[model samples]
Target: MTQPNILELAKQGDAKAIALLLNRQLQPKGITATAALKDGCLQVILEAVEVPSQQVLAAYMSKSIAGLGAASIEKVKVYGRQTGTKVPAWNQEFEMAGQKLPVADVSETRSAISTEVTESKPLSLKERAKLGDVEAIASLLNIPLRNKGISATASLQDGCLQVMLEGDPVPEEELAVRVVRRELTSLKAGAIASVKVYGQQVGEDFPAWNREFEIVAQTQTVKQNNNVKLNNHNHTLGDSIESDGLQEIAKNGDLNAIAILIQKSLAAYEVHVDAEIQYGVMLWLKLKSDKTLDSQACLNRVSRILNNIQPDKIVSARISQINSKNPKQQAWNKYLAFKEGQFIDNTKAVNQMTGAFCAAVVIVLIFISVMYKPTSTTSSSPASSSSTPASSSTSNSTTPRTFLGKSQTGYELWADKNCVYVKGMTEGDLARLNTDVWRFKDEVKLQTGYKCVLFE
Candidate 1:
């Protein structure tokens, strides 16, 4: 039957057909095959009368089974063994007179197994280093380094492994010692034999490995033995201690040593008795009085205080103003209000001055009206004479005297200053002239007794 028909039969779980087909294919090379269906997958086991190398046997089995075209076979396990041996032929073994022996005879055998088993089992420091395990080396170096918030990674290079460490910009000596101790415990010490260790901050592509030891070791002795002293006092801040302690004290509003330092620094100026910390670091110095003090001087005083207490902890400091309720600030506000009132008073004064000037102009116009006088006019009187005391006296006078008389067309008389000025007036021009003549005649009568004639 065709290969496709054999695969079809195997997929249907026909054990007999699958075994027959595999045997037919492998028997030519003195190999026997067995087929079993387990866990929904076809398992093939092969045996050889004359054992061959694993590579050769595996290749041969792979090719022969591929030729079978078994679609249902999910896993292929090719085991080669001599026709009578129970042990698999692929495993390393020693043979004496055709009898298999254990791998203990090879000296390097233990080391090779150590490399594989170390990943699963816990071993001593020396055993782990001998096996050249990357994880074990990293763990050993990181024990003390963790205190400095540093971590390391190991990779094998040439005969020695390289450990690349990363952490704070400032390196601590204790971290380096931990790394060196691990290296010494793992392997012998020599320029070529010792593991190479270097530190860098995160994001630094290249680290100065040659100078790293010198840089980290420079202050090692000093920093290790002592803590950072504040001012001339006995209080000290250790390298391992964080800035959180200082922040806590500041949050509680207790100036403590910080206040003492500031008070001494700014002895020339009046300093505030109380100080406050905002947002953890901003030191607010409350002033006792609102005097024009130098801002830079205050800043210098704050800087001196910080340098003594916790230099790196406080980012910035400044002098705070006195409260608004202070007497000095209230007086300053009153002065400003007085200036504003002066401006308003000046505006009102200007308005009153303008009104006075307008009143003077009106009074001057009235005075001119009261003082005005008009000149008299001369004209021939009518032939009809009326016998009256005032007219008889002015009969021979050539000057035309004003007379009170009715108009020929209209009943109207013109008079001025309580005296008759014109007679028989019919038009507006004659009437206006009559009124002026009357005023002049009245003035003449008052001065020389020349009276105006009144005609009925």
Candidate 2:
């Protein structure tokens, strides 16, 4: 008997029939596919002795849904766990049948499925949000935020998911980030600049791990917005500090150096620093400017320098000159985060700082990094590890931000210069096709939080 097309059933939100059809191949391997519709996502649960990895199952299912050619069915949530566990330990959201697969590794997903047999379980609110399910995202955030008496709305804009908190006694930017990062981890994000995610694992337990694989995909060079103006005043470039040296230290996650660099970099504008504080990825710089400047405009400059130095680092740089009457003296400044060569107007930055006169001192003392340069020399640029700053990074500033491409579909890869390249090189042979020399190799250890942001 000819079974109904899974795509059509999925589009109609018929979770049961879809599960029945999916179970045909899945069930034989001791993995049952039970699906349900939640917030427009088809939530598929796989229960077994042990759940398969989230990335692999999502990729496997992504290939399936994408091949079916259904536009109506846009989201899929696959959860895997022990056969009888109430909570699914494995869960990942797969944005499916679209121009791109949201899975971490496009090349791997495009390849054959893993031979390992595994099952899935129910999707949690956090998992549902990964597929751009607004309700799930909102529901997951609404409770805690409400308890804190903050009114907020969460949404997906331009492939980015963010939460907007309104009303009085707004939570500290650091606290807010903690909530977001801890609450909906599957929906983690940094700023975007034609960025794609790669090198992500299938899940906690799926076994198609190519412990020995490296992919470097590149595509056409593209131009981006360079709106921020740069004017070097007082012309003491080399005298201050080796911007290069400070940058090297910042790459090693020196929070102190990051603040000093920001202060010194803005000194040319007569923007004197007051207090600077960072809560997770959110950074607030309270300043006293003798010259009038728009908040966003100042942020644009800060964003540029930070991006130039850090590349893909996520720091919501809130440039606030206004001393809020609010007692806590929070950094209720306009939030502009640096990502992919620009300052993005991201979520509001919140923090507290006590400052008003450190710019002159900052500039004079900046060059002292020459004194603090670590004694041990490891030439590689630090991979954005917040914990161990000076470890495991192979590339430097020129390194093309390695993305295990969540947005990419194994169709194209490119440098920020938009230099395009194809993948056909052997396991170890690499050649520079573009004159803009970027570190290229066959291996990178991917992490969860900092450098490797796994998202679509």
Candidate 3:
């Protein structure tokens, strides 16, 4: 269809037609209706004319409004970060300063007020690199506790740490924000890493300043000692200890310490670990105790993370045994022993297990294919069958051959013989069909396949 006609149809709430027009216009420009939808103009139109918010569908159409209306947004100070329902499609009605407002309205208000504003906290090298401020983040690292006096500013240069004083004076402060990028296993001494100084202002008092530093670590840095001391004086495991400046503690089978350390390390960055740190801690304990499985730990961790984080961030992992003494292997061994004690042969059970494993593999492959598909298979496919049956002679002769598909009544599917039988009709189609409701004026006996046959 033409651009003007498409725009008109969109204004009339024909989402599919609007989408079609948008796609046609954007295809030549190497874009999709999804792209137009991202910019918000088309999406706002669709939403205003359409019934509900089509944000997800708008995203599908590529109509994103990134940084759109961000400048005029205001902050809605949340208490303890527990602002609203954590569930998706969740809604709550509450009184806000004596006015009742829906949670969705609150969310929309929040979004509109804080457009394009990121939640990046201020980090200063001078405060972090202080004599006792080991919690300071040189770049953008998370610290377990808050830095009360930590002060620094950062700026993105040719992508390196650049240090400056708070008052924009000299290079007195040696605290630098440096970015380091390397594989975890290859980290060693004398590695040149990329970094950035975040010299943004905080509150209304402090001016913008930057402090930069660089790590001398190199790729392929071997762990010479088992007791390694972290930069913040935290004693770590697998370190033999250092004699001069720092000390490392050694332990054997201390499950509590091991669990705590594993939890702390794993949970340090939420973005990195797929499993909860608590789960990691439990898994570590199970491994240390030579237990059969970490299922209990896994479930506990899942519960904790689910309670803590928003619904969108919840994730799961499927672990497999790579070692002979792997936990899963041990679990299977225990299961076999228990069954044997009960005088039951595990051969049949093992065969069933094998069948399940094969089925699981096939399911995983199919799931991956669907997830990685180029186009969305979740959306409705185009209708190929027309309602204008070639043999329906009593149907409105003057009306266009537009098909109004079947009508669904609960579990029962109903289709008018004249409309070629379909389920559920769109509002537009319903309105048109209502005008033709008088056409089947007389009752007629229909074949078993037909709802009712009309007699002239």
Best by TM-score: 2
lDDT tens string, model 2, 53-137?
Answer: 6666666776665554445567878888754346888788777644564332211232334364333535543445555676656
Q: How well does candidate 1 score on lDDT at residue 100?
A: 26
Task: List per-prediction Cα lDDT, in the order shown.
Answer: 0.42, 0.45, 0.27
TM-score of each: 0.21, 0.25, 0.17
Per-residue lDDT of model 3, residues 1-456, tens digit only: 112232333434333334344433322222222112222223312211012223333332222122122221111111111111122232211111322222222111333223322223342222233222222222222210012123433233343433222323322222212111111111222222344333433343543543334443321111222322212224432231111101100011122222333333323112111122234322212222232233333323323222121111112222221123432222211011111011122333544554455445446656875686554244434442335454342232333333333233221132343533222222233233321222211111121245443211
lDDT of 1: 0.42
lDDT of 1 by residue, 40-127 (tens): 4555555544564575445444444443444455445556665434576663211122222232311112332223222223444334
Off by over 4 Å in 3: 1-99, 102-149, 155-159, 163-193, 196-456
| RMSD vs true structure, all candidates | 42.8, 26.8, 30.0
Model 3, 438: alpha-carbon shift in Å?
A: 80
RMSD of 1: 42.8
- Residue 388 in model 3: shift from native, Å? 98
Our tally of clashes for model 2 stands at 32
